[model samples]
Target: MTGSVTLVEVGPRDGLQACKHPIATAARIGLIERLRKAGVKRMEVGSFVSPKHVPRMADTGEVMDAVGSRAEPGDMVLIANARGLEQVIAHGARTIAVFTAASDAFAQKNIGCTIAASLERFAPLVETARAAGVAVRGYISTITDCPYSGEVAPEAVVPVARSLMEMGCGEISLGETLGRATPCRIAAVIEAVAAHVPIEALAAHFHDTYGMGVANVWEAVRLGVRTVDAAVGGLGGCPFAPGATGNVASEDIVYLLHGQGIETGIDLDGLLDAAAYCGDTMGIAPVSRVFKARRG
Candidate 1:
C-alpha cells in the first residue's frame, strides 16, 4: 500500500479508560494481540495514571509488560508526568503520549491544571524521555469546542500544537472533545495548526457524540492529515466532557480510508472481530457504524 495513512488504534487505552469496570490483564492482552492481527502497528495499550481517577487503566503496566514485545515501533501509552513516564518506560513503551488542551477551561476540567501548567508539568518528562531515546506524541483537546468553555478558536488551537512540536513531540493529535464539530470547524482548526506545524505531522481525534466524528475525520484527511487517532469498536468518552462519546471508530476509519484508495493496512474483518470482543467484554453493543452494519 502506497501513501498509507497511519491509524493509531487507541482502543485499549483511550477506548477502555473511562469505563466503569476494570479489565482483566488477559483480556487486555488478548485485545492487543488481535489488534496486531488486524495490522495495527501503532496502538495505545493503556495509560499510566492513578487508579483512583482511571480505574480501568490501573493495570496498564501489567498490560504493557505482557504485550510489549509484540508491539511494533511507535506503540504508545499515555503518560501524564515524570512519574507516569517512569511507569511507561519501566514497562517498555518506546513511544509515549502526553496531553494538553487548546482551552484552559477544558484543561482544568480534564487534568486539573491550566493549559500553561499542564505544559509545564510535561516539560521535564518530555526532555527526560527524549534523552533516553524515547519518542513523544502530544494530544491537545478542545480544538474547536470545549465542554466547559464552549467554542474554542482556531487561533487558540495553533499555539498548543506548535508548543508541543517545539517541545520535541514528533506529532500532535488535535481532539474534538465534545464531538460537536462540523467539517468547516474542523478545517479552521487544521488550517490554523498547519500554519505552524507540518500538515503531515498533525492528527485528529474526534468523539462521535453528535454523529459528526466520521465526517470531521474525512474533512481532516482531505485537509492533509495523514494520521488519525481512533479506537476499535468506538470505545471511549472523556469523563470530563459531559455526554461525550467515543472516537470515530477504527473500523470505520479503515473502511473509509481503504474505500478512498488510501491504504490503512488494516483488515476490516479482523477489526470487526476486535469490535465484537470489546462489545462482549464491555457488555455494551459496539457503536461504530461499520460494526453495526456488519453485525446486521
Candidate 2:
C-alpha cells in the first residue's frame, strides 16, 4: 500500500524459544547465518530468557556469541529485562526488544510479573540502552486472544503499546500470539492502537494457526504498518496459546509482497533455500503453504 516494510525475521528467537527439543547450537546459528546470507537485514537472533524454563533457548549465550561476532547491521535479540540487556551488551547488540502481553493474566504467567511491573522493569532497561546509544523495541502479546484470559479487547492493547513507547522502545510489535486473530480482528486492534500510538511506529506479528496470517498481514499493510515480524519455515509456537501455530513464514511474506510490486529487499530464492535448510536442520518440513505449493 506504500513504501517498503521492514520484515524482521524471528526464526532464531521466537521460532526456537517454544520448541520442546533443543536444536543444536550450530544448527540454530546456521539458521541465522543462512537468513543473513539471504539478505534479511533485521532479525531476532535469540533471547536471554531462562534456559530451565525454555531449554530450547538454553544456548542463549553461545548463540549470541555466534551470531554477535558475525552479525551485520540491524540484527538483534528479544531481551526480557535489564539483566538480559546486560547480557547482550557484550554482543554489541544495539537493538533489543522487550515483550509484554495485552492480557494481564498472560503477562503474569509468561513472565511472573504484572503488566505494570513488566513495563516498570523494562523502563530502566530502555533508558540504560538508549543512554548507551542503543535502540529498543517493544512487543505486545495477545492482541487478539489469550489462552489464559480468553478474548482480549482492542482497547487493552493500546495502553500497553503506549506505555512501551513511553519506556523508550523505538517500535511496538503487536502479536497475535495465540494465532486466533482474523483479518477483521487485526484491523480492529490496529484502529484502536492508532488512536494512542502512531501507525508508523507499529508492527504486526501474526501466526498462521487458522491460515489467516497472510490475510492479517494484508490488513496491517493497508493500515500503514511498516514493520512485520515473520519466521522462516513457520518455526514457532506459544506455550500458553492453545492450538498456536508457528509464525507467518518469511518466504510467504516475501513472495506475496514482491509479487505485489512491493520492495522488501530480500532474495526470494535465497530465502526459500534458507527456509528449507532450517527446516532440515530442525528435522521438520517447511509448513508454509506458499513454499509447498510453489514446489509442486
Candidate 3:
C-alpha cells in the first residue's frame, strides 16, 4: 500500500488573504464547502490576524462560523498571536497555526517583531491551544532564501522548528516563502531539522516562483515528510516577500502524487473542479499549469 499523504488546502485562507478585491463572505464559505467535497481533509478556513493588517480576512469570525458550522473534522485556522487564537477558539476552531520565520529580517518586516520576540509571543498561544485540547501547527517562513536577506542558512530553520515543538505544536511547516528553494537546499534544511524533530512531524509549504514547488515537495517526501500545504488554483503569494509566486497548486500536486502511485485519498478530478470554481468565482485565471493545461 502506498503511504498516506495529507494535503492541507490553504486556498480559503491564504488564497483569499492576498486578493486585492473583496471576495464576498458567502463566496468564501462556498469555496471551503467545495474543497471539503473534493476530499480535502484539512483546510485552513481563515486567519485571526488583525483585520487592519489583513482586511481581506476581516471576516475571519464570520468565515469561521459559516465553515466551522459545517466543518467535517480537521478544518482549521491560522492564528498569528494570542488574540488571533482567542478568536478562533471562540469560533470553535479545532486546529490553529502559529507563524514565524526562519530569517530574523523576514519576521521583523512581516510581523514587526524580532524572531525571538515572535517565538516568545507564540508560546502563550501554544500553551492555550494545549489546554483547550486543540491541535497546534507551526509555520516557519523563508526556510530557504529570503528576498530581503538573500541566502538564509539551513541551520536557522532548526531552532524555530524546535521552539514550536517545545511549545506544543503537533507539526511544523517549513515555508519556501520566496519560492527560491531548490531540491538540494530543501534537503539540506530537512537534514538539519530532522535531527531535532521527527521527519513525520514536519510539513512543507512551497511556492512556484521558480517553478520548483513540485520538485522540492518530491524531495521532502523522499526524505520522509508527509504533510504538504498547497493552495487551490495556485492562489496565494506573500505580500511582504517581493516577487513571490502562488503556492504549489493543489490539483497539480495531487496529480503528481497520483502519478507516483501514492494514494492521497483525494479526488484529483474533483479538486480540479474546485480549482476551476475558485478561478471563476475570483475572476482570475488560475495559476495552476495543470488546471490550465487540462482545460485547454
In model 3, the Cα lDDT at residue 239 comes to 81
lDDT score for residue 105 of model 2: 93
lDDT of 1 at 104: 94
In candidate 1, list every pair of residues with a backbone clash: none
**Root-mean-square deviation per candidate:** 1.5, 1.5, 1.3
lDDT of 1 at 26: 88
**Model 1 Cα lDDT, one tens digit per residue, 13-111:** 888888776677888888888899988888988898878888888888887778864245667889887889888777778899998999998888889
Task: Kindly report which residue pairs in candidate 2 clash with one another.
Answer: none
Clashes of each: 0, 0, 0
TM-score per prediction, in order, is 0.97, 0.95, 0.97
Residue 49 error, candidate 3, Å: 0.6
**Residue 133 in model 3: lDDT:** 79
Q: Write the per-residue lDDT of candidate 3 for residues 117-216, one digit (tens) a residue.
A: 9889988888988899788999999998887888989889898999889989999999999888789999999999999999999998999999999999
The reply for model 3, stretches above 4 Å from the true place, is 69-71
